[model samples]
Target chain A: MSGKVTNGAGGSGDGGDGSEGTPELDAAFFARWMTAAADAVAREADRLTELDSAIGDSDHGGNMRRGFEAVREELGEEVPATPGAVLMTAGRKLVSTVGGASGPLYGTLLRRAGKALGSAERVSREELAGALRTGIDAVAQLGGAVAGDKTMLDALFPAVEALADSGGKDFEAARTAAEQGAEETVPLQARKGRASYLGERSIGHQDPGATSAALLVAALAEADTAVEPEGDADGTGSAQGGSGGSE
Target chain B: MVEAHGGKRVGIVLVSHSKEVADSTARLAAGLAGVPDALVAGAGGLPDGSLGTSEELIVEAARRMDEGAGVALLADLGSAVLTVKTLLAEGDELPEPARLVDAPLIEGAVAAVVTAAGGGDLDTVAAAAEEAYTYRKL
Candidate 1:
């Protein structure tokens, strides 16, 4: 009952699910999540670059920091009206700023996902899960790589699958899944991206893209917990309020 | 002016992680093609003068080269290719009919310029560039 705090306007009714009591997340929630991700990327930039130096280009850290910083700046200047708008804007910024493969890859992920969300003012957890799948699939197609490739998909696939299967309520589980997935990349000989050039030498090095992907998922969980401290225990949040009651 | 067969010549762009590489390739290709008026541009390097391809630069170059005949882009390496692909995927801001040609940089640029100077359309020019892979030096 505490999760029912519908205050959002414009019932997009895009969720289609019959679960009317599910909480809905707005643009502000998505902005908060992106900001949290920016902070996390900034804090771990050096670690990420170090990991990349072991097997791939040594620019992943700097590129990610620059890209997220642009995202943070753009969002701060003008917060978009809807969650989809915010993500789309952020994705464009990343694409234009980051001067590496990560830019386009990450840009496609957010842009496609945002496009899937459409103009819904508020999206339920289930809706968000579906949108994320659309985004992740775009990533795989763009990169021409699949799971076990020691690429970002190593972490992203598991995180999205876990999030979707849990009806998008288990951010903690998604975060844990992402972290484990990244860790598992340490022993994998890369089959895609720059690391693939190293052949067997790429083994024993954790994939920097996977590491950053884990941080992004962890940031999502952190953003949710920061908004609803009480929801941390039951895996629900106050930010995910509105729109669900209208439909 | 290089005469087009029946329409305007297709534009060519060389995208590389290094400015020097892109510019030099453009110069070599244009010089060898003997078409001073050909629309060939070089877009390379980040805004900070680093060794990376800039999406902004690619978009700018493509726009500058676009003359309603479409633009063909040849990228040097990983990030350069990705950047061009990203622009193609976004599709709105970039000029209409821009394509990424998957061919070796120097040879492809030369071939594309030669073909374009001969008044080839976008598809013909791109095919010529990609056909560089089959050129035999031996």
Candidate 2:
């Protein structure tokens, strides 16, 4: 686990080597990232809820939409000066506004990552990847859900792995990996969260949390493309909706 | 605040997926001999009164119920407990010394509330809650 996190951070200084020479991400990038996430959640809210209805409470989509909407409002109200501040503030809002386990779970993810980012004004892609690993670790600790639990970790762990493998330069690759991971949850029996109660009935449905988590990665990739369109034109930006499989 | 019970007692919060479950559990615990004056708050259900837990509601209840003493939370389900822990991790301006008691929900809430109402302090209430795990009804 620590090895993976360290490898993700190893590419922090190689920002200029990418095809587009991506700059260090600042607070503005974080803000845009969150806004994109909010939009994606809104657009996919019903699909998420439908996925949850099969094995869970069918509220994951609504919960995510409400949380991200609150985050967007907070960001618009008072834009934080640093990336950590942006994430921490958004995390706190998610905790307060969103109900259920996902609120706290997702909130802890961002808050832990934000804490790891510390007071840095800007962060290299590798630094962000490392910080995200810290966040995901916190999520696992909080939820007690491992990678095969048919939870968000199903998508998140693989996405983090892809990010590290690419040295954090390939957000699109991470997004694809997350989508594939989410799709992989369709055949898994849930061992955590509300869906675990369904037992074998959960085997055929894609995990709602995992699906929404993929959307979060998609949103981040979209935000990256919006900022550095020229840098990401090398076939990485073309795969818009490869998130296959029915819930 | 004046101590009608003669000393500061640990407060209690009941967290459940169902609002009625939390409220009724608090009521059941409150019926005990020493629990009339103890602060017992019910935090359950979504804002729209649906069947789910809410971290915001739990934090608000914990804040409202805590006096000079600490707060002990008893959750009915795993998600309820997770929600409470997550809210606590968010560093809300809750009173000092709030804890989640890990024991059977109704039994633990009853025991913890009874112990706390008797001025058992934080550790005593927690122990009483844990002791409920050994209670056999057979």
Candidate 3:
């Protein structure tokens, strides 16, 4: 509650900004997030590999699958109540269970985001942004990559900056910025880590991490729509929200 | 005298070098772990005129894990690792959290199977495989 921005116990909706958001992200949302993450990776596993093969060892997709499956399995065991803890747990598990650079990087995103949420049952757009900021920092720490590196950070940093500049009141705007940032990674020259080794070769091809980063942003934006009063406003109920808690 | 323990709740999987051995081994292991909810999958093994690929067996085992310790994948060598890698490749996205434990073929399988059935973690199954590493005089 302290870390996440929320609407309190009242039934106030956060709109799309995630500020004025739910005081508590439900379990259903957590499940949806996991499914979204898995689906995102599954949809682009081959594409991810194609991107990685050009500069790295060419096993990004395989590596992602191992982590995602583990996350899905872990979720079945226990779903953390808060949005942040989920990401933290998922991130840690991926780091410990999966091998290679991507594991630590992706794991950081979830872990830092979870930490930002603290123990709050709900999170505000600001809180989510803060958590992601922490996550982006962790990735920088773990991978030591900066902006325009043709790595995940290239996309992640811009997204974070955009989110922060918006003051956490506009999830849609934040989402759009993240998407655009991810796309911009394609033209940049890799400056660090494995991708940098390829030098000019890394150009043109989209960074797999960046693509996945965009998917995560898109998933968050989608979560808001699914939970909003108009979208699935009916009583049938559905698994809505981000996997931030289950990570 | 193989035994499968606590496997009933988690639903474990069995992978042998041969179908007959796989079935027979399941029977022996069942006694060791008591009656388990473990799932047995061995469609004939390499060098045994069996019908399935070791990769398929591992994939089956992984699927079983997803169905519920996650999964403990035990194989009778030959193409076990290769198949395991192959299955892992197939899971280029959404891979299950199963471990490929190298269990001894003849005598060791019984112990591995029993331990795996006991709701053992991938680590436990792997340890069992290592413990069951003794070569029989046969």
Candidate 4:
């Protein structure tokens, strides 16, 4: 699950001097990332609701779709100048438009990351990684969920860990980690959120929050691949890169 | 038909997943208290009248019921509580004061409304709501 950094095509040019040559992710990347997230959520809305119906309310899918649609609409109205501004606005929209515990939880994640990014027009991979850690931590704090709680944290915590462990150079790795973490939730009883009311009955059902969270990381990977296609001619850089490091 | 509450007393907001639940609960609590002066509003369900809480509705309720004294919020179930907390966290500027009380819905609403009718302050009315938590039917 962790290893040495292998410079992939996406990360090749940086001198490893650690700062001056670091690639700066721009607002365009953030916009594409959010759009990808909305698309993924829309595509999987019914599945998410089905998952929730097993252990919780059957509205997770609809709620997430509505929230992300609101985010897209807000972004369409006026594009923010910086990544932080874009994320902050998106977070605000989610909190206002989404009506469940997930709204505030996901809202805090993006808003905290946006605040950590500050007013910077762009951010280094490392900077983004740190900011994401803060964002996920805010989610944990707000929801009172830890990795084993069968909540979104089950997916989010591992994904963040993968991002940091990879020095933020591999979005694919994080996405895979998130997906795997979400899958792992199928066997665990929920210890938090509305699902906790189900007790042992919650086991065997995949957590809807964790499933959606995985889609978010997968969207991040897709956006990363799209923005930096130099070393990713096959469009499969992160997966290969992640595998290489573990070897 | 009953006369509306006419004084600057603590307000009450009932939050529930069902519109019928919130509205009926508010009516029952208001009736039990018989206080025409206490402002009570219901924030429940989606705009389409589905079974779910809405932050917009809650904020609107808080805005309308607030009178300079304060507002006590009573919520049913998990998502309802989360929605109310999230709304308050977003920094909406409600007139006067507001507090989210952790207590049983129907019983707490009755206690809270009665306490507010007597001109209780924010904390006092909230305490009255909390007191319902200890009420037992043995």
lDDT (tens digit, per residue) of candidate 2 on A105-135: 8889999988888877667687788989999
Question: In model 3, which regions exceed 4 Å deviation?
Answer: A1-31, A228-247, B1-138
DockQ of candidate 2 compared with the true complex: 0.60
Highest DockQ: give the candidate number. Answer: 1
Error of 4 at A247 (Å): 35
Q: For model 2, what is the alpha-carbon lDDT of residue A71? A: 99
Q: Which candidate order results from sorting by TM-score in descending order?
A: 1, 2, 4, 3
Error of 4 at A174 (Å): 1.3
Model 1, span A1-247: residue lDDT tens: 0242232554444544335444457788899999999999999999999999999889999999999999999999989988898889989998899999999999989999899888878777777778888999999988899989999998998898888757677889889989998999989989988899999999999999999999999998998887864433344534454544422
Per-residue alpha-carbon lDDT of model 3 for B40-137, expressed as tens digits? Answer: 44433533353333333445445654544455555553233334433343233213565555566534555655655555655665676667766556
Fnat of candidate 2 is 0.63
Q: Which of 1 and 3 is ahead in lDDT?
A: 1
lDDT for model 3: 0.61
Q: For residues B29-60, what per-residue lDDT tens digits would candidate 2 score against the true structure?
A: 88864456347878888767887788767878
How far off is model 4, as Cα RMSD?
7.4
Error of 1 at A109 (Å): 0.3
What is each candidate's fraction of native interface contacts (fnat)?
0.66, 0.63, 0.00, 0.46
lDDT of 3 at B122: 55
From the highest DockQ down, the ranking of the candidates is: 1, 2, 4, 3
Backbone clash count, each prediction separately: 1, 0, 35, 2
Candidate with more favorable, higher lDDT: 1 or 4: 1
TM-score of each: 0.89, 0.87, 0.54, 0.86
